[model samples]
Target: MKETVPLSVTESSEAEALFHFETGAPEAVRAALGLNATRIGDVVAVSMRNDPTRYWSKALGFGRTAAVTGELIAEVCAFYRAEGTPLAVLQLVASVLPEDWAEIRAREGITAGSSWVKLVAEVDEVVARAGAPDRRPMDGLRVAPVEPGDAGRWASVMMRAFGMPEEHYSGMAAATVTQPDWYPQAAWLGEELVGSATVYRFGETAQLFGAAVLPEARNRGGQTGLLVARARTAGELGCRLLVSETGAETDGGHNSSLHNMLRLGFRVAYERQNWVWQPAG
Candidate 1:
């Protein structure tokens, strides 16, 4: 008889820690933002890097966390302002805070951004689902681990896929793949690059991040191919679990990516609040 594998606990605190570790890692901090960009305090205040749009430039575990005070918010805002970031963000795990946390954030010039959902599943579960017969067939798509020479192409594809401006998109994609902790994958159809994704490995878990599919390639299995490729790659690298985050169902978008994640056997580990801070103009 075959043995059944046990599911690992997905504690909200652990997920929060994972988020911080990824954002504060030496390789990530250096590559995305640059040297000497973090201001450590009750929460880690990070300087904006290539993500000028305020999507990825935020203080990890900010006011939403325990022991974070108004004083700390002031300090964090000061650091971001010093770095010349036009806006600041505080990421709060919904499962970790009081119901009125949004009001607290509002009192400090912080407002809610997109609601984010964190999902996790066993590596084996993900790997097993990769070859399911019911899965969409990618007749001509090819996904492969990327080489340094492919940075520009990857960035270009991501720019078109994510609707990011050329300069910011290129800078983010190129710098991210160069990080020691990141492994990038590229999907192609014939001579054209169609998708991109990266797995950021740390300890026993790897976060599947930066996955994007070119507009022209939607509904053609490019993204699913990338997910399967990442799952296999993570397993080969000895990672025991896979974790990822996307916009929450309440965020008011179609959320096709979140649906795809569910099809891969990932479950919502928790939800988090994304708080945005716009400086008075």
Candidate 2:
């Protein structure tokens, strides 16, 4: 068995370095996607960005191994000091044990929320299908490479689209500017930032990290434009596949956005259960 090491919060750099070494993955890339590390007892717990079901699922398929338990949950909650957020707990489950979802809910004192299963779509398959397109077109939606000067606008759109608090956006932006693997593009209406998406390449597979559209920008095709652009970019970069995940519960539990992906040639590769445990009574 691979040895597990405890993480020390005070020594963040050391913890991050050790995590990178153990995973043989880039710290900057993980950090950019909000994958932070927290040490609990003798175990190191790393929380991937919110909605990590797809990320963990892909990792498992790629032969990575990890175990999940209440201890991991406690450690993640403590790391974020998010004892009051149900969503945070949900994200922790998605990141830690996407495959063994039933085990998570069966644990004593755990109440599963209206969570989601991860869905994936293949671009080639969608293109081959002759039917209604998954994504809608934006008449004048323009996409441009993110500029350092637009950090504040980009941050605002992320917060609005993802429902993230100010602090999380701040951390995400700080990590984004320094990560080479992250390719950020902003959607604009005239000069107003309306949406944004980021692409992260892991080996030959490119993962779509964050895709958010401001509430005001919804139904305007901002998201669809972003997805299509990213898919084309990923293909041009020599990636054989492009992947992303969305909440199965969103859009009245049908995942309307996922349908858009299907229209664009992505398919559901797997369904993962998202589980969470609140503080025991």
Model 2 ranges with Cα > 4 A deviation: 1-108, 123-136, 249-254
Top TM-score hit: 1
Quote the lDDT for 247 in model 2.
Answer: 71
**Model 1 C-alpha lDDT per residue in residues 196-235, reported as the tens digit of each score:** 8888776677778778988777778888888888989889
Overall lDDT per candidate, in order of appearance: 0.69, 0.53
lDDT (tens digit, per residue) of candidate 2 on 19-51: 432233345544445555544543444455443
TM-score for candidate 1, please give it: 0.80
lDDT of 1 at 236: 89
lDDT of 1 at 123: 80
Best-fitting candidate, measured by lDDT?
Answer: 1
